[model samples]
Target: MNWRRLQAVMVKELRQMRRDRITLAMIVAIPVMQLLLFGYAINTNLRDLTAGIADQANTAGSRALVMDIVATTVVTPTLAAETPQQLMEAMRRGEISIGIVIPPDFERRRIEGRERVQILVDGSDNAVQSAAAQLAQMPLDAPVRTGPAIERAISVVAFYNPERRSAVNIVPGLIGVILTMTMVLFTGVAIVRERERGNMELLIATPVSSAELMIGKVLPYVAIGLVQTSVVLALGLWLFQVPLNGSVLHVYIAAMLLIVANLTLGLLISTRAQSQFQAMQMTFFIFLPSILLSGFMFPFAGMPRPVQWLAEVLPLTHFLRLIRGVMLRGASLWELWVDVLALLAFTVAMMTLAISRFRKRLD
Candidate 1:
């Protein structure tokens, strides 16, 4: 209850933190790094995606149509398949995002006033599938504009993100990064700070249980993380005009789960570290992989199989799916329940492990 002592400790900690060149440098450097990485490096555009073509119609007209598809800068034709089964296998193996299946009647149909084309698009890849579908129709749409065309265009419209904008897709992900960085980095170092300051014995003597003490230490950090997340998200929406298609309540709920999962992870790391410096190092080690493999900056599909599988194990992977699904896809909680459940499970298990380790430490 001594205000003077608390204030003295707070000021001393601030001065010492400021005087520590590494901490000061990190505070400034991390933000700059995040800004640069997010601003320039993160692009949602699917570029140079591999495509496969199974051409039953090897006529001149069919070749020209295939050529037009290959010409589109977005899709690169990597494989020529003789059968539909081969095309399906390639797509299943993730070797090609787009597969063009030209039927035997493609050339005959085009010549006989029937420009009907059968396009098989991979729905699993939203962006690449859209791109491929557009390319498939380009050859037909170019030369003809008549009765059914207007009706078809009106019916099967290709509106500019008729659902979600790139900004909306991206900003929600930034929320996850903010929560992860602030909650995990700060709380991970908390107990280590107590140990470094030789206050572990004093804290252990208090009546607070290890779980209660950990919660008390983590709650303030969680609040700070939420505040930062709100500020960044508001800036993204207001300044960039990002759309909010899904329920605001759902976004906030997802944020809460993500914060708890990341905070518990931080608490676990704090329990394992012997000093604040070591905790900070461990935090960075965890932070980099989470950011890189979280599909925040890079497409998870673009990575090698081993790398993609590695990312699947991280909570950030599931959390990113929840954020992007709710914000960009306008998905309901029902659709995102898997990600929500995964995060909830991760939080529970991590918190239990941290609390168990913390109780042992108290003894």
Candidate 2:
């Protein structure tokens, strides 16, 4: 069986593996990252969901019931309203996932033994809707009693996406996912390939500075990213029937910012990676968390505080909010300035890192 030859070959391979520091690091890092991200960050049991309270009753009983709902920890009331109309508007704007409307006669009806309280849910996000439904059932089976005379009856309503269609929530997120995946991979490989082909040294010998070289590499990808965004949006709208309720200009601006951020990230990775394979591995490492912790597949609020903090730093996390806000809620750029600024900051930071890391001379 040539056992000696096989052992020699195995030893040679292990020596090569040890020399490739990036690959070695990936071997140790990817599994640990997967364990932490999936075990700690990915959660389906939704909690601390943003909710609105429309307390028309304005009575002690209504207030007590709201407190009870909050105590359950299933939803956290963040907005207050005087009527159901306001609550519905909040849900439509993606401000809250759950809305409680205590009618004017709610206290009277409860005392009379026929209390009805409306619970409105944003059905676009299936996970939030499912968790809300389960929580709503808790009060329905046995109403929350504020006093001996008060007994509540819950009427649950699913808004925006009454059908709880997965497509409605996923299509908008897919735009960010596609852009991140394509932009990062394309530019990361492009720069690495240039280095591998000795083109980087040729360019370095010329008058081109590192910053100029980086900009030259990234500029073409910006055009490519825009074309990709347009095609994806067009297809998503036509095939999935994804609604774009906001100004298309906002979407375009957000998309461009997201694209630049990812492209710069690719350039940064390429600067650190010696080979295209290492660049791809780096991209995958970033891409995994982007998909999992960015609230693309799961509810962002469901994750723990530490995990949410990690998510906040991810470019995809902010872009997802921007895309969903514009497409689902008709949110204006002014309303989403925080997310817009986050993306802008990411773009600038990544570009700066890439430029500073890229050396004109080969090591």
Candidate 3:
């Protein structure tokens, strides 16, 4: 309660903060970054969703219907699929968000006064699904009227997550979010704690190289990551009844790659941080963006193009795709190779950077 003592303590803390550039930068950068990310990147209004068209009708009426959907701007029909199966396959691979299947009888149905077309949406993303449904409900003007009494309507069907259950979509994504949070937090503190305890010098005095030391520290966490992934997957299946349609092995492989990437990123952060607290702060700096910008909460396509590009570089983004593809869509390895390769590249790059930055002797 002494005024002079409180003033002295406050001044001491201010001086300490001034000396830690990383902490100071974080204090200033975090709020500004959050404002920009949430303001510019996060959007609920879905637009330009990649659409696949399976025009089995192959008639003028079907073509006109496709154009009408495109004009709505809710879905862009960029892909032409030869069959309904092909359109569904594109959705499974996350190549397109909407699929329009014009049956061969579509024109005939219109002529007979019972015209209906199917609009399949990737319901894994609830926002996109809702928007697509609204767009589909909008009445379309028939290009060729076979009869004055005939009516045209579009039926919206949700695939992969028919009921539009939030758990069905969110639980698989939680796998990536959980891995990113735990892997980064655990490994971020490891090396800094060792250095703080003066064990780093002892290790350096030994013959172990920097890469060997880094890998040694990271190897144990890989097992921990696998255990965490399995537990989450089991709970999601049991509690949420989330389907695991693809091979479990593919999910395991993708989880392993994602874990390694995040762990290596943690190691890199630990090398830069002078204390465990700084390591934790750096982890938060990475964590916030990973969760917000990585399509965990918001649809990736809904974000601005630059933010979408940023999401593409985050490990969580690719892992989400992999987990969702395997769990919901039953996508095979070949279909998810792009995401796998992205995770692999990130892991290797982060591993190399962490080793190169790790010093044999403590500063």
Best candidate, TM-score: 3
Query: In model 3, how large is the Cα lDDT of residue 14?
Result: 95
Candidate 2, residues 1-363: lDDT per residue as tens digits? 899999999999999999999999999999999999888888888899999998888888778777777777888889988888888777766678899888988767777767557789877677877887787666423455664322236667886667787888998888899999989998888778987998877887799888888888888988888898899889988998888888999898988989999999999998888899999999999999999999998889899999999999999999988887787777787777888899889889999999998887778
Order the candidates by lDDT, highest first.
3, 2, 1
Q: Candidate 3 lDDT (Cα, whole model)?
A: 0.86
TM-score of each: 0.62, 0.92, 0.94
Rate residue 46 of model 3 by lDDT. Answer: 81
Instruction: For candidate 1, give the lDDT of residue 231.
Output: 91
Instruction: Please give the TM-score that candidate 3 achieves against the real structure.
Output: 0.94
Q: Write the per-residue lDDT of candidate 1 for residues 1-363, one digit (tens) a residue.
A: 999999999999999987776566768777776665455444555556776778897877677666655555656788999887787666544456666667787655665555434445444335654565555444443543321231122111222244434565567788988788878888888888888777888877778898898788877776777677679878988997766667778887888888888999999999987668867877886787789778776765545556667677678888777766666546666666777788889888998998898852433
What is each predicted model's overall lDDT from 0 to 1? 0.69, 0.84, 0.86
- Judging by lDDT, tell me the better candidate of 1 and 2: 2
Q: Judging by TM-score, tell me the better candidate of 1 and 2.
A: 2
